[model samples]
Target chain A: MSERLEEICSIELPTGESVGVHRRRFTGGLGPHVAIVAGIRGDTPEGTRVAHAVARHLSTHHERLCGTVDVYPCVNPLAAHHGARHWPGFDLDLNRRFPGRADGHAPDRVARTLLDATRAADMVIELRGAHPAFREETQAHVRHDQPVALERALRANVRVVWRRSAELQGTGTLAAELPGLICLEGGVGNRLTDGVGLELCDGVLNLLVVAGVLPEDALPFHWAAIQRPLVATDEDIVRVRATRGGLFLPSGRMWGEVEVGTPLGEVVDPIAGETLEMITAPVAGRVLAMREQPVVYPGSLVARLVAT
Target chain B: MSVVFRLEAPYRGEYALHRLTFGGNGPAAVAMVAGLHGNEVNGIQALNLVAGMLRVMRPKRPVHLLPCVNSIGADEARKRWPFDDRDINAAFPGDPEGAPVERIAAAVMDATDAELCIDVHSGATTVREHPHARVPLSGPELEHARAMMLPVVWRRRGDRYEGGLVGAWRGAGREALQVRGGRGLALDMDDATTLARGLVRLLAHLGLISHQDTGTPSHDTDHVQDYRSMAGGFFVPEVQTGERVVSGKLLGLVRNPLGGEPIEEIRAHKAGMVLAVRVYPMVHAQELVVRIAEDAT
Candidate 1:
């Protein structure tokens, strides 16, 4: 076991200031190299925290590992510096600048450098947090056609393993770049939640063990302690939105099962304090996400559900 | 006034685009367009103000005024197309049979076919901007920009004109200029009036309109510099827009919102006019704090 951190790249801003991107490598013997990346968007601090946690555990037990494990805790350090969602001066979403140019601006150079560093890995895993306005249940997302990713995501100790079509996913995202990549996300954005970081850390470690990069006995917890997730498809997931603009008060809890037409929340006028409407679940399912922020627009998504 | 184009909306009624033409017409002259992004109401206000002036006066050459292009977005106070959230300015020289915003861009481009064009805009939501003209350094466009007699005529580099409406106009063989003022989603009456007067001055310089008091054109420096923040925090700015500054001057200070510890100090790099300043100061690291236009020696 060695304690070594490699500085992969450094991006120099227009003002002659720079930020370093560091990657930790755990190598035992030779097999397929697996890369774990997180915190592409600075608002998702949970991903960075989980990546560091997994790296810390892997460093202690690196001697028993088989394949190499590379962990990039935070890719966009400048954005992370201020807890912002986009690159600072550019006001650009870094994830959207994939396959970037080396000779371009600072953000482009950083994207190009990160892409180059991870291109050679046999498997890639991206960790993210829920949007800033909502809290999500721990889940793993895999492309429906990627059988390998679907099989690997089952061991991530998440509550729901969603296999969705690639077209449904947004363009220029990390998952869009790597077709079969597993994306694990939970918790709230910009702020850390209780127990979410540890849960995601354990999931990544379990994934590393399942990939034969880390030995089973090296895991901090027993294999039986892992949660068996309910595997689902795109059709089994439903998004519930509010029709009125107001404060959305969610009555449901994350990952809690409910019957059809169950009362999920109420939208009330923030000033008048009058209940405008009551939002209800359309089908019997488990609440996958609910709005944490009170204020909402008319088309704002209030909850996500995993149907039975 | 002519109805150049019309588009149908899903729930709302149809939108009609108006183009006002002046003069029996000599050689086709400048085409003035504004309100490409609907939330930039100052541009629309300035164009309309120019339109009112054009009604009383006659020009020696032809001038086309496209006052408001994205009326739907303007109605909702949105910067982009309300339907698809697409920026009309980005889809320039657009397809006639494309999406709603693209079709609007194509129609606007077709309507404003002239020798020279000027696209007017306001600043983004948070910042207030002085009436200024932006053009590439050392060109005919820069000369036209200087003739406007606006407060700040910024001769910027070609690289800064990437993928915008003005860029697309230049790409299509028309000498294009970009004029900016006020702020988005709201109208600054004085800035809009100043910009309107500047447009009249540019038209008179092109022999399109004859009006006195175009004023003695100030030959300002073409060199411009940007000032950026050093750290991430709530920035408290000490300077206002269009204020003159010397070297080592304090532009703003980044302080911790909770405990009020000074995180960083933003200072002017050179002696110049503060053309732009950060108004809403919840800033991230390396964000732009001030942009200065250095006076030519």
Candidate 2:
């Protein structure tokens, strides 16, 4: 069986140049169709990299694969090209335009097209990177109500499996549009993180196996190589915010365990270089995410922790 | 005029939210706000014009005008708060104990407690809009919009007003409506003045002021059509906002950017008043080139 690259939607620029959102499909015998989508936001290159990595593996093993696997490498190419979070000219967040209109703007049409293409699949997997301002540990996020997604996320190679409640699922988000969608996210935004891409690629391949789209023996790595992720609910997560406006210097390491009162970071006066505030861990947990951007404001989120 | 809310800034001195008051101190009849999006200069100019008019003809009831709510945003000509880059308008009915924008939003809610409230805005920077009031299809809001007698009164679904300052006010049980004109970044003085006149007319209709200015009735309709480009190119609009168009009128032309060859000609299918037109020439495929508020059939 040969792999096929299909164009789902085309974005035409004013210069008569065109960019297309594509899907790479791998089909063998008829089985569950699993959709792997990435790069909804331009800033998240890690997700796009993972999508391609998975695509490359599927391409190499297309003859051995069962069922169908559709991988959308990068949805928002324009934003990805400029390394920005939103579409450049429109300055609109593609993530917020889910279930978009058929006759709307460029972003809206792409969003609508993406939803239509992926909605019919048996399983949909969304790949994402943390916000550019923060560096995050590998995690799989599934809606709390979705037991099947939660069950599938357990097999996804990641540090933590966060089950976000219905209330936490913001309106207009892709997660809100698809109930059983499993969102695999990790690493820093824009720039790819070491080992993160490999873990996610392995995870996607494992999912293909779990969905019966790919044969278990076809996976390059053993299924046992997948890490057992900690299952966390909304209550298990803690968000730490800064109390002062200054430059934040993170003292904690990524995925490092912390005790109560452990020094997470310090906020210093940007100009005077004086310590304005010392940020301490409020609970005993592991650092889930840390703000890499130096600038800080009162109530600005600096870190997120998952209580052990 | 007085400071309604204040926040201590780390680098800059204290941030102040000011309100210009007119007439008696009794329960305010109306509270008008603008510049929630700092780059939208038309609303700021319109409110300022209203403020200027209110100064001379003292309204019988108290009126509050909070012009340029996001002063920091206006300073940098940004839509969101400068410090955190968060939309202040989105943080409506906000928390005083929460983020900076949230605190400001909460303050705005408290300070603008009135029987009626209005949030003014301008179209996106790339599009130009005529002065219009967007209200529900029916109810007191529609009646009030009709009283404004602006160039256009577009009846929109209540669901569309789910998250902004207008939504917050409506949620709090205050009668609220939104009016917009011109475009962001640059001030179209004519449109701004037109919006101001409409507001003045509404105040007079409410018996809040003694002045009687019967502004021309609007082209009222709930049905509006947006014309989008089928292909990407340099869009040349044939009509301006507020211009009346007939069937088969050449609304715009999409021409190749490099060469002068015309790609597509957009024509109006039915007669209507132009509600919005794209000011920026360069357009992507499916981009909104024109919006027409059709006459009721």
Give lDDT: candidate 1, residue B71. 82
Per residue, candidate 2 scores C-alpha lDDT tens digits across A202-251 of 99899888888888999999999999999999999998988777789999
> In the order shown, what is each candidate's alpha-carbon RMSD?
9.2, 2.0
TM-score of every model? Answer: 0.62, 0.95
**Highest TM-score among the candidates is held by which one?**
2
Off by over 4 Å in 1: B1-297
Give the per-residue lDDT digits (tens) of candidate 1, residues A1-308: 45478888776543335578889988888877889999899899999999999988887788888888889999998899999888876667888888776765666667788888787877888999888888989999999999999999998989999999987776667677788889999999788889889888998998888887887899999988888999999999988877666778999978888898899999887777899889999999999999998765455678999999
- Candidate 2: where is the Cα deviation over 4 Å? B7-14
Best by lDDT: 2
- For the second chain, the TM-scores of the candidates in order are 0.94, 0.98
lDDT of each: 0.82, 0.91
TM-score of chain B of 2: 0.98
